[model samples]
Target: MTLLESIKEPQDLRTLSPPEVGELAAEIRTFLVRAVTRTGGHLGPNLGVVELTIALHRVFDSPVDHILWDTGHQSYVHKLLTGRQDFSGLRGKGGLSGYPSRAESAHDVIENSHASTVLGWADGLAKADEVLGRRRHLVAVIGDGALTGGMAWEALNNIAAAGNRPLIIVVNDNERSYAPTIGGLAEHLATLRTTDGYERFLTWGKGVLQQTPVIGQPLYGSLHGAKKGFKDTFAPQGMFEDLGLKYLGPVDGHDTAAVESALHRAKRFHGPVLVHCITEKGRGCLPALADDADRFHTVGRMNPLTCEPLVVPAAASWTSVFGDEMAEIGAERPDVVAITAAMLQPVGLTRFAEEFPDRIWDVGIAEQHAAVSAAGLATGGLHPVVAVYATFLNRAFDQVLMDVALHGCGVTFVLDRAGVTGVDGPSHNGVWDMSVLQVVPGLRIAAPRDADRLREELREAVDVDDAPTVIRFPKEPVGEPIPAVGTIGGMDVLHRAPDPDVLLVAVGALAPLCLQTADLLAGAGIRCTVVDPRWVKPLDEQLPVLAAQHGLVAVVEDNSRAGGVGWAVGQALRDAGVDVPLRSFGVPERFLAHAGRGDVLAEIGLTPVEIAGRVSAVLERRAAAGERIRPKENGA
Candidate 1:
């Protein structure tokens, strides 16, 4: 068996010699490339962290000494070392999670895959350890890209002040998160990387000072106490030192021995310490290493040998539709600017950035800053489009409400992956945006049904000069255009049966599903009229009136059923005293597990068959109740 196969748990790693450990790293990389190619996960990041993860497991005993991964995309090696090596179903329904999961192992902590959160978790864990009088260490492995987040700095400030806490902050300097990390922190890290003055001083000072007999011990002690000041004069990693934390290395992250050595020193220190390790993203794989574009950070299922996608390409996705339109919008309005939270390519802003380089801004992983800055940009006489994943937008909600919505700034929030982003698991799903944003008064939300509407509504969203507007779409490829047979107010009527008994309200990409559902109902001799309310937030005034005509109204959306379009429509109908029986269909409140989007939808009863059956059952119940209530003509 190979060294990798021999390591069933972290403890198994201890049995291996130094040479075997190095061999283990090589084997793990090869295994990851082969396994991940089949399932398609965060390949480049995992490739970069093989040695780092091995060193971490070797240095710290997990479940006892907490080893937390920031962002968690780089935790595949960590998973392997912790005896969770099965990668056949990675990111799939019954498979291993792409990020750390407490359910998977006792070693995994903090399942939230959002960036820059590990430091805060580390600080809290360290505080608990100190309070409990435990000697167990807290090590947070955070990427340099994560350091760009403001929360990382906030945690650093708190960690620094707690000088008695033994915490090891491992900065995995890969120089990229999605795209090259932006902002001042990235620049500071770049500056710190170039200077080897600290390492050189430690090596030279130890040898020369030890040579002097009796004075050597005392002099070295004095110099060690004054090491921060001496190091500040040379390496200038004083950023951490100034904050009352010990700064260790610019260690080569790919070198298992070097990383372990740095980790060892940090673990020995009494107080908080920061170890900066430099590693190339996509270290082992030639294709990944050669990739200049975000280092192939996240990949789809691909050929193991060539890295070419196995699946046939579909039509333009919702993101691509937005990107193409944003470029045209940029050309028409020079004042239109775009902002991304360090995900230019993923969110489809790459084309816009290429077309109008000066108009685009990548604000690192700071969603809060992106919203607030967009508000600032709007006030400065420019229309700002803040493009981000719907899940990530949750971070900026307060900013969007306080800075943009309250102040009445014209900022368009283009939310890609707005609903049921299946494979990434619960944390990555964008289903909660509609429910959460319900409280933001005056914030208009548009859920486009097709690529045509996505383009049209995006223009409308940006045109609003006073309030914040949101345009949200799903992760799936843009479906064939569902044409409106008629329009009532802002709602597009997609299907209408003569003598309609049911009014079907379709939200966003669920239009096709609603159309299919209407067909099923019609096949059963139940007349159904389907309408797509392109804008979901503000219930179209005509909706209540239209609902009154039908015996029952069913609202379908990809968002949560709690406070989504269905709830809004029901409330509107109630206030208008329409008294129509209403049924809401959407994702349940519980967190959905990793699965295919179609499977999840079917499981949640969002399928046309399920929806039709439910509607038929409801109608049958209503008809039976009607017969019991009404006096039969000659029944006496």
Candidate 2:
């Protein structure tokens, strides 16, 4: 059997010889490339860490010595070695997650599929171990790119202050972050890789000292003892050392045995040690390595015939629509510039970046910085449209509230993936955008139900130079437009019947489901009207008047039930004293696992049948209270 097949756990790795372990690293890389190609996952990052992962597993007794992956995207090989080798249905509705999942393995401590924040977790875990008097090692494998985030620095500061805390930090320098990582850290890593001073010193000193007579062994031991200082002088490993942590290597991360030896030595150190391992992103894959862009960071299912991503018959997503419209608007308006938080392609800003290369900025994986920076850009008299994933925007809440909203910056925040990102898990769900943004005083929020409205409203958002505007949409593509819809104060009435008994207030992508529910209610002897409220915030003045016309109103949204649009609508009706009974329906406050968007929606009672049932119950109660009711006869 192959060495990979033999490794069921970390203990299995301890059994293999150095050369055998090297062979196993190659085998693991082969398996990862094949499996990820088929599964269409974070290929480049995982491929880059194959040897580093193998060496880590070989050196540490995991579960005892907890090894946390900073951004869990690079844990595929770690997963494979930990007995989840089967790639069947990987990243499917019920399969393995694209990132490290705590449900999948005990080895995975953090569930962040997103970038950065691992250093903080390592610091916290290490402190806990010390406080509890536990002897287990805490090792965090972080990327050089992750160092860009402010949170990572905060954690590094604490880890440094602890001074001799049993923490081993592995800086996996892959030379890329979605795009070759920006800023000072990337440059420093590049310098470390090119110099190769540490490696040369080790080799030259070993040869020279051994040839010397009498006290040569003693002299070499003394030299090796002060290796940290030597490395500090020759190579400016001063970054880690200045932070009060030991620094080792710009080691060849591709060599499993070399990495294993380095890891074993670092494990013996009491203080925090950063072992810099240099490896290529998309190491084994030629196509990904050569690509100038994201290098297949995430991909969809491939066409069997063409080997390209499988294309389907669907309307353009709200993100792409916004990008296209933004580029067009930007060309006309010189003041309009675009910014992304290391998610240009993911948020469909690639076209914008390509068209206006100088006008667009990609601030690496730092959401808070992105928001604050956009505020500065706005203050400088530029209309900056900050495009970020809805979930990721939560990271910049402080900046959004304090810098942008408080200052009334004219920056437009385009929140792509605003609701129900299916497979990326709870961390990625944009469900909280409506709930979270409600707290921002001057922030104007708009949700688009279809592609055309997304384009139009995005332009409108950019034109509004008075206050900041946030345009949000789901992960799925925009469905067919409701041609009969009418708009007023950001709300769109999709269908309205004269003398309607129930008013179906729909938000964003829930418009289609509400339409279906309206149809089902009509067949069951009820004439229902459906309205797509495009702007969920600043509850339209027409909404309370519309509620007065109906005896029952059911608000359907794809956000959390707690502070979602549905709740806001009900509250607005209550404040207006419309006297109409209101029922709000939306996703409950909980973390849902990997599932298809439709299945997840259904599970949360956002289906047509469930919505219709809710509307019927509200009407029944209203009738019992002597309120006027619509005809019980069939309306269809």
Candidate 3:
């Protein structure tokens, strides 16, 4: 068996020789390229961390050590080393998850896929251990890009002042988070990155001085004590050391021996410590290294040798449509500026950035800062558009409300992956945006059904210059534009059945699903009308009026059932004194498991079959009374 297959647990790595560790790292990289390419998972991040992970496992005993991975995308190697080598179905049904899973192993802690949270987790774990009088080691492995987040600094401030709290923070400095690290933190880390020469000098000094007997030992001790002076002269990692935590490294992350030695030193320290390691992302893979864009950060199923995609999307993605339209918008409106939380390309702002270089801001991974800064830009006389993933925007809700909405700043938030993003698991899903943002007073929200509505509503969102506006769309491809049959007081009538008993309210990407649901309900002898309310919040004034004509009204959205569009529409009906029997269909109030989008929808009863059956059952129950609730003849 190869070195990789010979071990089933992290303990197996402890006994490996230097040559063996090198061989194992090579084997892990080869295995990763082969396995991850077959199943389409994070290729570059895992490739970058093979040696680092091996060194971590070897230098510290896991499970007992409480080693944590920030963002967790680079934990695939950790999984393999911890005995989860079966990667055949990664990110698929009943398969290994893309990130760390607590259910999968005792070795994994903190299943967070969001960036810059590992330090906080480590701090908490260290405090708990101290309170309980336990002697467990806590190691938080964070990416260099993640350090840009304010939360990380907050945790660092606490971790630094914890006085004798034994915590080790490993900054996995490969210098990229989907894109190159941004902001002042990236610049600071770059300065520290040039201090590799200091480490080399110290290594040479320790070897030469320690050989001179008693005086040599004293001299070496004196030299090591003056290490901070050397660091200050060579670099300014004093930012970390001044915070009160011991700082080590500028170690080569690819050099397993160097990393293990640094980790061993960190383990011996009495207080919290930081070890900075320099590594290359996509280290072993030629194609991954050659490709500058994200270093193949996340890859689809592909041929490992040729690096060719096995499957290609048949249509343009919603992200690309938004990107293209934003370029046109930028050209037309010179005052319109764009902002994203370090995800320039992912959130469909690439074209806007390329077209208007000075007008775009990559605000690192700080969404809260992005919102507040957008507010500032708006107050300064320019219309700012903040584009981010719907899930990530949750972090900046307070800023959006207090800074933007309260001050009447005209900042538009474009949320990509706005609903039920499947396969990446619960943390990545964008289902909570509608429910959470429902409480943001005066913040108008638009849910576009297709490419046409997306472009139209996006323009409309940017036009509002007095209050915060949001445009949310899903991760799926742009289908053929669904033209409205007619318009009813700001809502689009997709299908209208004569003398309808039920009105189906479609939101955003679920418009097509509502149309299909209408077809099924017709077969069941239930006449229906389907309408798409493009703007969900401050819903069309005619919605309650229309509800008064139907025996039953159902609001369907690809968001959480709790506090979602259904709840908003129900409140509208109640206030209008319509008293219509309302049914709300959406994602259940639970964290959905990873699966295909269609599969998850079916599981959550969002499909046409499920809705029709439930609606039919409700109608049958009311029919037993020889009447539908508050029935209106001819929908009047």
Best by lDDT: 3
* Candidate 2 C-alpha lDDT tens digits along 34-62: 67667667778888888898889878888
Give Cα-based local distance difference scores for all models: 0.90, 0.82, 0.91
lDDT of 3 by residue, 99-202 (tens): 99998999988899999888989889888988899997889999998998989999999988876999999999988898999888898899988777877789
Root-mean-square deviation of every model: 3.0, 3.2, 2.2
Model 1's lDDT to the true fold?
Answer: 0.90
lDDT of 3 at 375: 95
Could you estimate the TM-score for every candidate? 0.96, 0.93, 0.96
Residues 188-261 of candidate 1 have per-residue lDDT tens digits of: 88878887766687778889998989999789889889877876776678877889989888898988899989
Residue 444 error, candidate 1, Å: 0.6
lDDT at position 106, candidate 1 = 94
Over 4 Å off in model 3, which ranges?
202-227
What is the lDDT for 407 in model 2? 92
Cα-based lDDT at residue 237, candidate 2: 79
